[model samples]
Target chain A: MLFVPGNNPGMLLNADVYGADALILDLEDAVAPAEKDAARVLVRNALSACGYQGCEIIVRINPLGSGYTGEDISAIVPLRPDMLMPTKVSDAGAIREVSRMMAEAERESGLAEGTVGLLPLIETAAGVERAYEIAAADPRVKAIFLGAEDLSSDLQAIRSKPGGEIAYARGRMVMAARAAGVDVYDTPFTDVNDEEGLRQDAELARALGFTGKAVISPRHVEAVNQAFTPGEGEIRYAREVMDAIEEGKRLGRGAVSLRGKMIDKPIVDRALRVLETARALGLGGAEHE
Target chain B: MSKLVEGIAEAVRRSGLKDGMTVSFHHHLRNGDYVLNMVLEEAARQGIRGLTVQASSLFDAHLPLIDHMKSGVVTGLETDYMSGGIGREISRGVLGQPVIFRSHGGRPEAIESGRVHIDVAFIAAPAADPLGNANGVAGPAACGSLGYAMSDAKCADTVVLVTDHIEEYPLIPASIGEEDVDIVARVDSIGDPGGIVSGTTRITRDPVGLAIARYAAQVIEASGLCREGFSFQTGAGGASLAVTQYLKPIMKRLGVTGSFGLGGITGYMVDMLEEGYFRSLLDVQCFDLRAVQSIRDNPRHFEVSATRYAGPHAKSAAVDSLDVVVLGATEIDTDFNVNVHTDSNGYIIGGSGGHSDTAAGAKLAMIVAPLYRARLPIVVDRVLTRSTPGKTVDVLVTQRGIAVNPLRGDLEEKLRAFGLPVVDIHELKERAERVTGKPETVRPGGRVVARVEYRDGSIIDEIRSTEE
Candidate 1:
């Protein structure tokens, strides 16, 4: 995922060139408070006119509690982004409120109900504590994202390096999203210049079971992509595990041995999940053993 | 016509038997240099004693010249600097005289001032005719610039153009014109191009080097210098080139356009220039075939002489106008004193050619290298030799971390504010020593092989040879 400032027409026009699977045309945090209305209008026009070239475009609107939330919904709902992200979401009530507002906007614009999905950004200590409720709140909610910078600030914690801080929040968010049957994403790494740091953080996020990461800079996209993709070695191991499971089934056994390592149903199920994730991420089709 | 001399030996005899005569050579062939040894052998055979030898720079291949210096056939040596075997011999007082070191730009200045007049200048041409018109781009050992030899050919009263591949009467686009030539001769092979390009010139993949490169690029971007028209120059080294690679994607995303790349040209720089990332490439010496081909095909690739490249007095050298210059270091003390001449063992395996000149001139001078090499720590409590003054080197980038010169307090503040991974030079040295045990002290034998002179000709440090 890549974040493009809603007011940046140049970036919006060149979004496909970045090779991002999805783009979040951010209306909050990126824009000045005074220019919120203007940014909303620009984003609406960009979505209406510019061709996204097959990229999933998501419009990150202001929180429902903010003054500009009504205008943001009224303006962007008609344009129809793949998803509408609510920033600093704290609980189920906020998701429910945004869902209700989105439904009303859809009716007013004469668009179909449930057409736009919701992606809530959990940004504070309160939001992390209630991530499960937020993920389970609305059928429209598809993913929950953990924002480390805001959480760190709210908690008054110092993050010196990768894997030291934010590990607990990242882990909790992924677990909550998985339990609620929604996807989870890691927050943006503000240090655009630190490629190694970015790679290490992205790898950690991926290992912790996040679907993807939000990148502040286009330079971060390639590293994030490589981190998420399963290499040939993993694919081969997954195939071996599946083959062992099939042989065990033929022999009326619950487990089997592959290269002297015992393989069970859980291991076979995990291998299938990897193959599915790889296929969904467009890595390659799984070859049966 | 005078009796034709068969080899360099006969040519030296014909030039005249004399003591105290100044002879010069060019470093066009770089480390693969063989013409220096070939000529010195003849000088030794002719019993030419106490003759002063002036070359652009000494390389390991010219180690055989140590015999000539010890036998009194060579005495006063003047060049940019000496390295490897020649430097070791000179440090032992084998020549019985102090060696004079000059900058890449200062060599021309010294010759033009008549301070170091040349009696005979022997130029190794890759391809030349009998009348002495030569071209470096069309020979077996083609090293594409004779810029180092231009001053010698112009100032010397007797110029001998030696060629391995003799072409027709007129070689097109002659680097050294026929009017400056006094004699021409053909030989088997001038030198090997393979040896010239032997040093490490690729991007370093070591974790520390990559870390430093990343931080340096970050510093550049955070300083707001990632905008359009930014100029850069990285020397021929793996770590320096890694900076270029790291900067490429950032520049593309920022939509920043660079004006030009300046240095001893390499193929990597040529690719950047051709990719339209940079508007032009200012080449002083072509390091490989890609640069030579780029110079031949692309008009944007301009070749300038050494004086124009970094000479302090030149109307405004290319290096002086650079935004950044990435350099390599052999040793850097906590005080930031840099030594590109001697290793941790105090063995002279390198020179100070253009290292100091560029550091003092460029806007941001960064030295990127490993903290230790071959279990010898490069970041030390005190440098064994001081080639470039630490005050001029703005930043030291190692695999461990980056250390900005405290003199640039504003830069330090800005870098820290940007969340860069920065550490003090001393801390970096300590970390390096922890990984590779502290280097053993090299005992200095009381003889000086070469004197490292500051840009103003002040003796900063004297290079001593390793005791046998």
Candidate 2:
């Protein structure tokens, strides 16, 4: 995903050409306080006027108490964006309020109820603790995102490049979202110039079981996508494992062995998931072969 | 037999520059050149009138020529390229005769064929001996590869060498020797070193530019010509130069060794030559300080004259051997005709320095540009000026998609087989129109302001004066 400034028409017009799976039209932090109302209208009209190629458009509305969320939600909900990411979200009540507002707007606009999904941003320390409740607050909550910059300031910790300060929060948020059966996203690596550092950070997030990572720069999109995709060797081995399973089933055998190693249920499931993700990304798959 | 004159005034007097004669100058010094202004000032002081200025290229530093045109000192203009400073005045019908615009190759061809007679040629040498032997690789205003001036030295009736640095008896390895020079004049300074060569030529950081470059590189790779002994040329524009940068890794991965890198050389091309990605560099001009240094120190970085570079009348030129060339455009019509001479507003901003020559010579000629700039589509229904005809152009690569010329069906099939986004040229124009609504065509009115001459000595297009 890429975060495009909501107020910049140039960036907004070109947001989808960068090959990002999702575009976050940011109106919370990128737009100034003085231009909040104007940026909301600009983003709403942009959604109506322009085609984001095929990217899933997510509008990042202001927090619940910012005095602008009500208008942002009302103006953009009628556009039927793919999702709405509410910033600085703390507890289940915040999620419920935004969900209720979305439902009301959907009904008034003649869209089916829960037409737009909700992505709760867990930034504060209290939000990290109650992440599960927020993720499970309503059926509209599709995913929970980690905003480490605000969470570090809330904890009064020094931010480092290796991101030791956010380790606990990352683990806790991932576990919470997993327990609630919702997808989780990691924070954006802020350094636009450091591709090596971004690679390492994205690898760490993937290892920690985050479904995807957001990027603040378009240059980082390719590197992040590369780090998250399964490699050629992995894809080849997954195809072999599936072939072995098929052969075993034809022979009526109880177990399948590939290269002197037994392919168990968990291994089969992991292989299937890898092939599924690779197929979704339009890579070389068994179907193509 | 010293051949050394006191100053430009003496040189102008000794050359017998008549009132209606044509004098020429090279653009090695680019925007920092003072020799053009100084010589024209002396000619004006000498009460010369109706003189035609034949320069290889003009820059913003040559804005004084506009004043000379107004004062009747200069009545005619001929150049391969003109920057916006002087071009704006020309577009407003300042000169009595229309400016004759030619490709870098066509300029030398016209000079050699005697179709465009030169009465005098002023060569700006950074370092020269009293015997009129000079080189561009020394002194304070050291601009490497004095390639454009070599033609003027050989064919002009009178050749005057102007230099700020006077060397000892014999300047070894002189780019322009004493045999061709008539008078050697000493000046305080030829040009500012800062503007002669750029300090650094950095790759583009714009994502849109990079995306276009990436697609162009892919097109080159898919052309099936990127094998052993690949020869390439690209301009100094950010996106054009970035294509060279992107091709570096592809060449490495494929173990492809290019025969030569051509055109106005940049530091990135120097690096590629030094790294063995290319066996050598054929430079007609140095665009940066690194290129100047490399041309001075490395034997592999050889300099060639403008005629040898791309002159259509020459027996053969380096452009004939080129596999690919990447160019930029202000506007490209659906037919692939490119207009680099005028902007969308019908204002003269650039010209075809090597655009037409290389497009005619290269096997695959690709144009890299964004689909739209500032809400104006780059692919228009028709261009304001046709600097390069559509038949020679092969591909148009934009961030949205790549459009191959319908004439090259084989290339279109190759790009499609590689899974590259190959769209019809008309569809590409439509894609741009969908984003930016159809723009009103700009039809410049009034008398003709410039005549765009192709490399083959035919008038391809005529640019009319812009109405205020």
Candidate 3:
């Protein structure tokens, strides 16, 4: 859902309506090399002027040392967007560089320190290897997203439909995120018309323990969100399990059974996590996920 | 003995538009019409406050009403349609009171029944005599139909005519005759004639729009309604009008001729009539120049009063037999309640217009819009405002899928059997959400500014004030 091109004002204006929990106004990849300067200016103006129908605003700048990333950061940092996503981030050095520039810009612009967070797109083999270190590099490095297209291209392998080729890298990214105590986003599904494909990919990414999936089209948002969020049956089971486990514990029993399934500690823990995930997904009460 | 006055202020004084009273205006001149703004400005200058405006419709040209609302010169609004300028501000909660929406026929019926009393009525005349006989056809700003203003002239306590041209006494062929007038105030120009009718009424070529139009036609065809002598109505929106275009081929293929095309007549509908698709066009409001000339020239192209069009009080209005109406929506909830009143951000960019009325009366009421606009999902948990009831809404046609209300099991069965992309409302909501993520629910702040009045005059939903 976060694919508003920096050059397109109409896209930027409508970015909120598509309900991308966060909108990444793209300053790189989406803009042509010749139109980079114009796109930067338009994105800057839109950031300062247009109100995003309540979606979290994130601006994805071009890679560091690309000559445009510096300008993009300098132009957008003053507006204090929720986050800045620097594409093709290979190591902690690139993150540190962005952090320094953002700090300098934040100070110069009179914004509070540490107001802007960083979302580094881990695309290279080197970045995937250094995921945990890069995520733990800066306090502002809130989330690490796996750029599957770039990573797959770097690995010189064709992407499998069910994500077999990207599985190792995705698993490593997820573990690294957990180790670093930060969120990790899966790569965006590219085929806009393929809803089933998007849904399967999102479900696979969610199963692999990614926090959220990246979105190329606004159409991909719902699938990713739903895949990441627990559903009604799961929520009901989690609630009942939690309630039963709580009752057993109150009665001084070490374990309990519901529907002939062993209600062990790990199962209880998983149920708690499920309920927590549901609550965080904005699903409230015992009704349903 | 003549009713001609010096200015709007003089006319306001004559009509007794005091603090805390209701005044009315018509939108036949549409976006080009200047009388509403002129009269409201005069009212604001007169230090009038807490006044309600009962307009037949509002256009983008009435942006000045925001200031009037802000300054408390005008607080409430009652209208059938609104075209975004004042609407966006109102949705952001600019008005202290909510704008009541009535149908085209309901507006007049409300006035006549004393449900809504107008202290003064301002008619934007193209030409009016000193004695206050006015007609739209005989002036520089001819808008073709003054149907919306007729009832206001009859029911308002005092009636004021604001026109640019001053004809001699007893203007001939008066659409609004002299007997209803108390005063006439001449202005330099009522408004730009070109700006009166909308320009977006053309059949949309956008493939998404075309796909939706195609599906809507198929739904109508599958509903077992598109036979010979079938009747229909649609709004002046690009997508809605596109349904008119796509339906032509289907109607031609089926060799089915329609009875009449109703509501705000457009050139597209006129073309359909001329092409032998429909027998006649019953226009309450002419939307384009071709329609205007057609009404003036063609015997088959006729002008109908608002009462005869969609009046709830009528024995049977034109909407009663409406086979289908393809309308657009800002949002539609899981329950099938549709909101045309506000955008996804809860900004009032539109009003009910004929949305609820046609839905109530039409055999098939299809809410046609993209599943998601911009990045905002059109299908939601609950609409921001319920302009039309769920039971009245039969089908929702979007580029993504078509949702038939559970109330219409037959519609669902028919659409599914025809191999249409029939999905449940909940499934459509999920389909929309699966792509656009769940939008942060927009909650209007703690104030009720307006109530959506169903065609039966019952409060269907309340629009809350928002500071957005």
* Model number with the top lDDT: 2
Collision pairs in model 2: none
Docking class of 1: incorrect
Local accuracy by lDDT, each model: 0.80, 0.92, 0.83
Q: What is the TM-score of each candidate against the true structure?
A: 0.63, 0.96, 0.62
- lDDT (0-100) at residue B220 of candidate 3? 93
lDDT string, candidate 1, B1-468, tens digits: 632235676667666637889999988788887888888887777667788989888887888888887777888888886767776666666877778777787787677667679999988888887788886777887887677788788889888887788777778878888898877766677898887654334666443456557766777776666679989888766667778888898989899889988878888888889888899988777777787777767889886777777777677888888888889988788989898887666766677788888898888888887766767777888788888898998888775567889998877787788766688888888877765668777857766667876775578988765654
Model 2 Cα lDDT, one tens digit per residue, B1-468: 668988899999999999999999999999989999999999999999999999999999999999999999999999999998788889999998899999999999999999999999999999999988999999999999999999899999999999999999799879998999999999999999988999988889888888889889999999988999999999998689999878988999899999999999999999999999999999999999999999999999999999999999999999999999999999998899999999877879989999999999999999999999998999988888999999999999998899998989999999999889999888988888877888888788979999999999999999999854
lDDT (Cα, tens digit) per residue for candidate 3, span B64-173:
88888888888788998788777767766787666787777678779878888998888899889999998777678888778888888988988999998988887876
Candidate 1 chain B, run of 10 with poorest lDDT: B198-207
Which DockQ value does candidate 3 get? 0.02
The number of the candidate with the highest TM-score is 2
RMSD of candidate 1 to true structure, Å: 21.3
- Summing lDDT over every window of 10 consecutive residues in candidate 2 chain A, give the lowest-scoring window: A280-289
Q: Give me the displacement of residue B266 in model 3, in angstroms.
A: 1.2
